[model samples]
Target: MKFTDGFWLSRPGLTPRYAVEVDDIRVDERAGTMTVYASTTRIEHRGDTLNRALLTVTYSAPAEGVIRVRVQHHSGAVPVVPAFALAADPGFGPGIHVDDEQGILDAGGLSVRVHRTGGWQVDFERDGAPVTHSLARSVAHISGGEGTWMHEQLALGPGERIYGLGERFGALIKNGQTVDSWNADGGTSSEQSYKSIPFYLSSRGYGVLVDSPDHVSFEVGSEVNTRVQFSVPGETLDYHVIAGPTPKDVLRRYTGLTGRPARVPAWSFGLWLTTSFTASYDEGSVTEFIDGMAARDLPLSVFHFDCFWMREYQWTDFEWDPRTFPDPEGQLARLHDRGLRVSAWINPYIAQRSRLFDEARERGYLLRRTDGGVWQWDLWQAGMGIVDFTNPEAAEWYVAHLERLMAQGVDTFKTDFGERIPHEGVVWHDGSDPARMHNYYPFLYNEAVFRALERRYGVGEAVVFARSATVGSQQFPVHWGGDSDSTYLSMAESLRGGLSLALSGFGYWSHDIGGFEGTPDAGLFKRWLAFGLLSSHSRLHGSSSLRVPWAFDEEAVDITRQFTRLKMRLMPYLLGAAEQAHAEGIPMMRPMVLEFPDDRSGFDADAQYMLGDALLVAPVLSADGAVEYYLPEGEWTSLLDGSVQEGRRWVVESHDYDSIPARVRPGTVLPWGAVDDRPEYDWADGVTLRCFQLPDGYDAETTVPGADGTATAFRVRREGARIIASSSDARAAWSLQAGSATATADGAGTLTITIEDNR
Candidate 1:
């Protein structure tokens, strides 16, 4: 994708045709668009335009504060790929200001100015202040031995940092990186990502998303020091410029364009134990693991059966391997009887040995080659045929089996392995371009399964542990970091990936507790247990080893019990954060920069993140458990202990296996539940409202969601020396904790107390 040999020279065998000047402009008042025809050379006379291809660029707005620019070199090449599955928004075209030199089209607060003379440059301004610009030569159509490519480069400002190229793990700041927007199954160590979103937000309060599902390459300040360049392998290039003064605002608009994540169930916030992949596990093994967890007082809410649930070479058969699980219905019923929701592993693949494969091949439910034969691969399984999600009947045929499994007590599915979709010489049922459908395959696959679950179980009750994703796949809740090694480095990389994904508008993310590739040591397992339990979703899974807490050590079991109970007790606060994510598209697990954008320390603090708006969680990733995390200006208090630490500097601390650096931010009223073992309960009953240093003029409030789909609001404020606490229900017996003092709420649903030395 790199066409330049140096700053001033093009590469060999490359002919770059730059859009020098705008030749003509046609304004469409009805469509609210401005179309420009830019020729490679200045159109001086009638003979100057002979034998030349002019680029046609259209400027339009899909929503307020969003500007979409579509550039095409050849207009007759019809694209079979579907548009990157985005939600439509009919924007109120703000106004159009035209002059002799330039035309400024204002949409919401963002303005795109098209230069009518001199160099062909498009300048983007947010609220009349210059943010970024596409210089004359920055927009080009290149033709070479590598074929045709359309490229665009946006000016990068000083100290501008880029983030969110989909769950990336390399670095927090994407300044000197080369990222490709392609989905791959590479683990946490590589540049390849499971979720390669074609969007990125900058520190300068603007974001750009290349609206191409095909392979796109980005050189972030690498090829050129002052611009972020992206190229696609086609004659047409399209991108959207989103303006936000704040990082959260950018994500809000981005998710509005795509879709917001669905609200996950309350029970999904609890611990999940999975059958390790490739491990010899039968119903007895699963039962023993459950029994062991119960005996150790470890709280588990969901149990997942991995790929072996189906027989070998029959992945999408959807039938339990009767040799191991005789009476699968009875087995699931017994697990449900023990108050546990069940999940089974499924992928969008059907091996040829299975009966479903024969039916699908006959019904045209599988992806086919150009010669009319079904596409088959032997990577994950023998003769695996991918289900063509482009066809409606194919999706229905696939989901019908999932519905049957759910009817037999399955709660959710771990939709894995959409990254291995074929792109070369393939045909989609709906005639979508194979190259574009490669990365978008997961979106359709997960959507079909998610919608099926919602139809069966109702809203807020469906969840998928998906792995691969593209731009809009964040609508599916609970995507986990893919295959990782059982090492400290992998844990840190997993954190980086999750933090990046959170910024990319995914509300909930999880990772394998003790890694997924190999068995972790006892110390590593115990440490990862704490980190996993604190995530928005927690799961214990591995590739070749058992992920049961007792599989590591007795201390591991104790640590699992401790952190699992802590997360359960913190559900009142976590569920509220989830509700916020559903309403406004901010993530439950947030990067520190999202909360404190102006703080330089928070911008590079990838080791730690804010659990919500109120609590800071720094997972200790070192073998020695030594962590150095920064906190913004505040008076933070440890949720583990009542000890306080003044912020605005880095805090170096060492934690044991039982604890992490979890501190409550100032001006927070965190709600804690009484029941520590079970995740689903009346969250308002026996709830304790822990009021952290609520600076005198500020008020803190939280809503605790209960099992019956109702929530109670608890409010606390500090006025001078007296702290006032109020609840929505007068009969709710809740405790109020301010510093070291704890008092039960009075009968009037309000409690007033005076601190000795109120800040």
Candidate 2:
């Protein structure tokens, strides 16, 4: 994707043609959008124009502060794969004007300038100052044999950092990296990512999203030290420049353009236990694990069955192996009786060994080769053919099988393995280009399954543990970091990837606790247990070995028990934060910078994160149980022991299995739910309101949702002698505990409380 040889010259056999001169400028008759047509070659005379190449430039404003510029070289070439922009109708914004004498096209506050009559240059300026510039040779139409590409170069500051290419495990800051927006099955150790988005937001508060689903190559301060370049192989290049004064504002605007993430169910925040892949598990084994957790006083919510639940090599058959699970219905009913949800593993590919494969082949539901036969491969399964989700009949057939499983007590699905789509010599039912469908296949596949789940289960109750995604895949909740090794290093990398994904408009994210490839040491397991319980969603899954707590050590069980109960008790506050994530585009598991944008110490702190806006969680990544984390200028109290610590300093401490670096910020009113054994109880009943150190005259409010999904707002304001608590909706039964706070109410949804400053 890098076409330049150092700073001055282009690589051999590559012709980069950039727009030089604007031949004409006009406004559309109806839409009134400005269009500028520029020629690639600068013609000297009238006779020299016949052989010169021309690239057309059409610039317009789709919305305020959003400019769309399309550059095309050959008009007769085939349309490119990976269609740009996923939204159905983005609507229109303001008008555009062309000032020929000034040599600039003004699109609202943004301006594009043409320099030297033929040497094309566009400068995006705000208040008569340049924020970013696209020079003459920066925008080029590239050609090499049958493949063509359009490249764009935008200015990058000297020390600005870039972030948010989806689910990347390499670095928290994406400087000096060559990233490819292509989905691959590479594990956590490699540069390849399962969720690759062609959008990056800089520290300077601007973001550029390449509107392509196909592969996009990005050189972030790599090919040129001062510019960030991206190229997509096609006839036209389209991109949007979004402006924000802060990174959170950029995300808000970006998600406004794309779609915001949907709200997941409240119970999904609880701990999930899985039958580890390839591990020997039967009805007895499942019961033992569940009973073991209950015996150890560990709270569990969801029980998942891995691939071995079905017969080997027949994954999509959707039937449990009779030998292992002879009575799946009764078993699931028993688990449900014990107040646990059930999830099963499934993928889109149907193996030849499955009986449904022939039915699909006869129905023309599988992707076909050029010769009109089913495309089969032996990569994961023998003669496995991918379900052609482009075909409506195929989607219906796939959903029918899943609906049968849902009839048998399956609640959710682990929609896995959409990254290995084949792109060569294949055909799609809807006539979509195969190369474009390669990355977009996951979107269609997950949407089909998710919509089917919603049809059976009601809305706000459907969830999927998906692995891969495209632009608009944020609509599907709860994607996990895929395929990591069992080590502390991999745990840190998983956090980095999850934080990156959250920054990319994903509301909820999870990961394999204690990794998925190998059996982690006891230290890693206990550490990961605390980290997983603090996540938006928690699951214990692995390969080869069991992820049962007792397998590691007795302390691991205690660690899991304490954190699981803590998360269950914190559901009132967590679910409120989740509601905010659904309302705004901010992430629940936020990076440090998102919470503390003014704090310079938090910009590079990837090892820790702010759970919502109040709590800071720094998982210990070392074997010694030692962690060094920083808090911004405030008073932070330990959520585990209620010990107070001052901010603006690095604190190093050793912790046992029952404790880690978890703190609640000051001026926080956290609601502790009544039930710790189940997550579906009425959270507002018997809610123990815990108030942290409140600065003088500061006010905080906590809203607790009732069983009917309606929330009651508890307003608390602190004054000199007393604190006042009031309710807006109804008279909710509540109590205040901790810090010697005494309460008295007047029956008009108002209460006055006084607290002594004991601290």
Candidate 2: the clashing residue pairs are 20-118
The numbered model that scores best in lDDT is 1
Which residue pairs clash in candidate 1?
Answer: none
Each candidate structure's TM-score, on Cα atoms with residue i matched to residue i, is 0.98, 0.95
Full-model lDDT for every candidate: 0.89, 0.82
Candidate 2 lDDT at 738 equals 43
RMSD values for the candidates in order, in angstroms, are 1.4, 2.4
Question: RMSD of candidate 2 to the true fold?
Answer: 2.4
How far residue 656's Cα lies from its native spot in candidate 2, in Å, is: 2.5
Model 1 TM-score is 0.98
lDDT by residue for model 1 (125-154), tens:
998898899986788999989489999999
lDDT by residue (274-347, candidate 2, tens digit) is 99999889989999999999998888889999998999988678889999899999999999899899999999
